[model samples]
Target: MAENSLEKDYLEEDTQHGRYLTFSLEEEVFGIEIKYVTEIIGMQSITKVPEVPPHIKGIINLRGKIIPVIDVRLQFGKEPVDYNDRTCIIVIDIDAVSVGLIVDNVEEVLNIDDEAISPPPSNKTGFENRFMKGIGKAGGKVQLLLDCERLLKSDEMEIVEELFEEK
Candidate 1:
């Protein structure tokens, strides 16, 4: 019985450790769970799909698979900037749908404890608040933890579907 209790405690602690793939957008550091990440690719030529939202940069051919790209900065309502050498597209798979998110650069993977994550601020003053799941305190600063699933919700998918149907 004591051994079973110890095992349970270990499992609980293991679950508390959240791994995030950190990245930079503008000057702020942001993170998303590693589980959702597919791959990080350098900036590629995107074939513009017309009439989609401005944030939807377009689609890219990934080894014969066409994946839609969303400019992360633009989606967060930031001013548009030219893609430079440091630009990258982080492919993510959520709910069986694959999409690419354009970021300024890819940072690093970090393991954050549940205790270090705090709920988002009540006042959604900035771009960080709308998509952020929480503020993860690490490495002497807060890493904006993004709720990727929430950020790329079904509404976006429906828009894409409708666009394709029209085309």
Candidate 2:
């Protein structure tokens, strides 16, 4: 089935992972595999769209391309904070679709090997850690690895596509 092939490809991609682009959401640090990252852009003006999810802050026009912007903090059910100079949009490619994840600030990209990562705790239920790929350890610090595939559901992606089509 097509799903099987997609899963296989994702697994292979996981094997090729090494570097992670680290960023912050509040005081906690998080990292996403560098392979999926396209570019890092500073905070930009967003066109607000109605009836979208709370986390979907709206869409941005990035050099003529319209892409939905997700507030990582709000997506995690955290309190909304004012966007400041340090706020950034981490443009990432997932399944050939580009989505911008608005993060607090970006830290340096680090080479976090597979051995330095561990699975998230399984005892919990609900959305907490739902998008976590792993917990990474480096230099006495921890970074929650984000699974981009899990971060945005297909239905939500559909909503985004519809918005663009209407524009």
Candidate 3:
């Protein structure tokens, strides 16, 4: 549960302020800006697609929308674990395209002040650091703030798009 703090304490920028939907990945808390979150759905049957990365769990037809789901654990390079009742997808709009993020469990939406967020560590040499928008501190808890736009890069986005298009 002790996730590494991304950066040193810096001046809080007001632009980061807003409601964030926090979720659990194991014990670590992660937050995605609520502006991009569409809704939360229980883990349903996901039709696996061929030739995509393992992290890309494949697509789901929610009512009618075909949204690709990515295992956040796998995306973070963590060991794969079994999905339980608490497991669900946080459907978010990344640059307008809807995608589902499979999280260990969904917590609640939190109103994180800009002052509570710290910049991502400049010293990190890992890929995960690239996706971090900042580290959020609220209610004495730390939440890894994710940059939704960067969650899936242009090329990765293209890959996800093609997964279902090929069908």
Candidate achieving the largest lDDT: 2
Candidate 3 local lDDT, 24-87, one digit each (tens): 9988999999878899999999999888889999999999889999999999999999999999
lDDT of all the models against the reference? 0.86, 0.89, 0.88
Evaluate candidate 3 by giving its C-alpha RMSD to the native, one decimal. 9.6
Off by over 4 Å in 1: 1-17, 123-128, 161-167
Question: Could you tell me how far off, in angstroms, the CA of residue 135 lies in candidate 1 after the best superposition?
Answer: 0.3
RMSD of 2: 5.5
Give the TM-score of each candidate.
0.83, 0.86, 0.85
Q: Which residue ranges in model 2 land beyond 4 Å of their true spot?
A: 1-16, 124-127
The lowest-lDDT stretch of 10 consecutive residues in candidate 2 is 121-130
Residue 45, candidate 2: alpha-carbon lDDT: 96
Clash pairs for candidate 1: none
Per-residue lDDT of model 2, residues 1-167, tens digit only: 99999999999877646889999888899999898999999999999899999999899999999889999898888999999999999999888778999999999788887899999878555546778999999867999998988888888888877876754
Candidate 1 lDDT, tens digit per residue, 47-130?
999888899888898998778899999988888999999999999986766789999999998988889999998775654466
TM-score attained by model 1? 0.83
User: Which residue pairs collide, candidate 2?
Assistant: none
